[model samples]
Target: MDIYSKAIKVFGKETQLIKAVEELSELQKEICKFLISRTGNVEEEIADVKIMIRQLEKVFDKEIIQKWEEEKIKRLSKVCEVVECAKKN
Candidate 1:
């Protein structure tokens, strides 16, 4: 198994889920700090969150998550198009 899968196997799903929450919280704090001071380890926090998110994909339904991601991307694309059009006007 991959490292992420190995981590999930070594640590139970519940523990990993809690860790994911903690990582997300840390990322949120880092973002807030970065916005306030233009200084913080946001990139590192993002990497941590990404790792936890990958583990979460392994723990849950990846296909469903992928579908939702696609839908959200489509919605974001439409919003971007609107913003771009407004910018040109």
Candidate 2:
């Protein structure tokens, strides 16, 4: 599905557009994290990553959405970090 279709599927249209924006942003972030750890074929990997990010931008389309996404990603990391710390300690 295209970005817009995927967004509507995950979150109904009755939901505010901002909610769809947030979900798309989070998806892009997850893809980027996976792309970053690649071991080889940098050119192909970068090309795929750029396309994925551009698709997300088509949905989010604003500075506020970008900033909100970045902040929430940091918060989500804390959740994993805390779980990791508990395992170690």
Best by lDDT: 1
With a 3 Å backbone cut-off (N, CA, C), the pairs that clash in candidate 2 are none
Q: TM-score winner among the candidates? A: 1
Q: Which TM-score value belongs to model 2?
A: 0.36
- Full-model lDDT for every candidate: 0.97, 0.64
Range of the 10 consecutive residues with the lowest summed lDDT in candidate 2: 38-47
Q: How would you encode candidate 2's per-residue C-alpha lDDT over 1-89 as one tens digit per residue?
A: 78655755676555535554555566566667668874345455455555545545655566877899899999999999999999999
* Candidate 1 per-residue C-alpha lDDT over 1-89 given as tens digits, one digit per residue, 9 for 90 to 100: 89999999999899999999999999999999999999999999999999999999999999999999999999999999999999999
Model 2 Cα displacement at 38 (Å)? 12
Q: Given candidate 1, what's the lDDT at residue 65?
A: 100
Model 1 segments beyond 4 Å from truth? Answer: none
